[model samples]
Target: MPAYDQTRARVEDYFDRTATKTWERLTSDAPVSRIRETVRAGRDRMRDLILSRLPDDLRGARILDAGCGPGVATIALAERGATVVAADISPQLIDIAQLRLPHDLQSQVTFHTGDMLDPKLGQFDAVIAMDSLIYYTASDIGAALAALEPRVSGPIVFTVAPRTPALMAMWYAGKAFPRSDRSPVMIPHAHPKLMSAAKSAGVRRMLRPVDRITSGFYISEAMELRP
Candidate 1:
């Protein structure tokens, strides 16, 4: 069997321990390797794209930054005047995010370290999960969306690892030499297949495919589900 086993626990552990510092640095203005620089740039673009889906003047909006690592998107959402609940699986990462947030925006963000689909997160006008679902199976992604759909009155924006020749090769390589220190293997998904999973999960809203971004080792496709 391929050495490819990824679960929520593993992902959380990796982020909380193995990669917290790296992620913190990468998300910051600090310099990084060339490959990481591309990733940073791509993430920035994706964050901006996700934010664009929300209203320009979010004076009273309540948003969820699902699986928010270091709270970059959470910061942006709060800056737009939205009250953001930044939820992450890793408590350590959430702490880092809390520290990184500007003092003025502190009042706008509430940090939660647990499942993003927690009902106690209350509801949201919109949600964005950038690169958070890329490591999970299609079915899991679908179930997550299903859980979020009822609570969100607006759009549920997210990203996935699109199945492409290059990404497929990377997936295989990951299976061949998986390690705990590395990021979890990203499950590649075809748009049609993902949409089918979403449908199966009772998410009635159509999964609208947006732009696919590729920068060095980073590849993710953004989509939005609106009510």
Candidate 2:
């Protein structure tokens, strides 16, 4: 089987077991609407940062939301008049994303289940993979990015966590968090090196901070990929 399929299976199992609990934790601090509002606030900020860094405008652009869990950000972009394709490895998550959208926004958004690295998605104007690249190794991440670049006519916006001592401490503190891996944890993304690798793949880099509290986290840098 392809590595994407294998990773998909692992991620599916991880979410099947932990999604409910994670939802509960997120919603524990706020009601559903409030949670959405808070998340939207952060997402809008990240989107704005991406817009500022990117050379092209995303308004009315075709967008691919890679690993778009629950489609929160996808729906947000759709609301802003972007044609959005929300793709996730988990069908269950895609279903949730579809159900979560209103009829009008649903008309503007399309949800699909597929591996992030798959080349069959055709092409898009922009791609956004927020908080999703942590599931792969460095080589896998590069492969995924390479597979993604041709599809993007404009730029790519994604986030990666910095690998620092403070970040390592945070990961250890949250190590008990549910994981599908039966073996050692994989550290796939590193911020400084990721920018270098992306540059090698024919994408110019721009980055900024994403302001959200994530578990097992370090500094989250929002990246802009210019071709």
Candidate 3:
């Protein structure tokens, strides 16, 4: 297996080559109308969930989305009247996201090419990484939590795979979804120390739920960074 850093770069490259196609692939199995509704609903729910955890009003809050992928969440925040800065490592993904959004809403969302570990991002009322943080190592996750700590003025919501060694071993060793570029075969392993790092970083709210919503590959949680 490739080292985490190398694999991270490889995964980014893989997405860059296939970002436009990836969204289509992810939505292919479902009905087109249902897919749209699901995605919109999911993004709205995520926005509400994140905003509810915040102290500042979200009507015009400045929100930053790290590794925003195709920018669905970024667009959702913008639609909710937020000033969103969506950053991704892949410019191609950002392009697609930009194209998907409206011209007027375009002004509300500024897409940038950047990584989570970079120090140039400055700060925001909330920093949401969604599923992108799965690309980090234990130390990387810790560093990410710490890096966003200063920038996070209100809350930070992130998701990851399960933390159990058995699940991690299975994902790292088996393939869940056949014929998917996602390498259903190889998935990121969540670290136990992440919870500690989050708490130490002043995260007051934690939601850890292991269920089908995660597609049975891992558990999904929302860590609310308080203060």
C-alpha RMSD of candidate 2: 4.8
**Candidate 2 colliding pairs:** none
Q: Which candidate has the top score in lDDT?
A: 1
User: How high is the CA lDDT of each candidate model?
Assistant: 0.88, 0.64, 0.62
Q: Which tens-of-lDDT digit does each residue in 1-227 have in candidate 3?
A: 13546656766776777555755344235344554555545544554565455444367788888777777677777877888888887777777778778777988888788665566767788777766766555455655677677766766766665466555667655554454455423344444576665556554555243222232333344554455
Question: Which lDDT tens digits does candidate 1 get at residues 10-48?
Answer: 788788768889999999999999999999998888888
TM-score of each model, in listed order = 0.95, 0.73, 0.72
lDDT for model 2, please: 0.64
Who wins the TM-score comparison?
Answer: 1
- Model 3 spans > 4 angstroms off: 1-7, 25-57, 164-192, 197-212, 216-219
Q: Model 1: runs farther than 4 Å from truth? A: 1-6
Q: What's the lDDT for residue 42 in model 2?
A: 54
How much does each candidate deviate from the true structure in C-alpha RMSD? 2.8, 4.8, 5.1
Clashing pairs in 1: none
Clashes of 3: 0
Residue 33 error, candidate 1, Å: 0.6
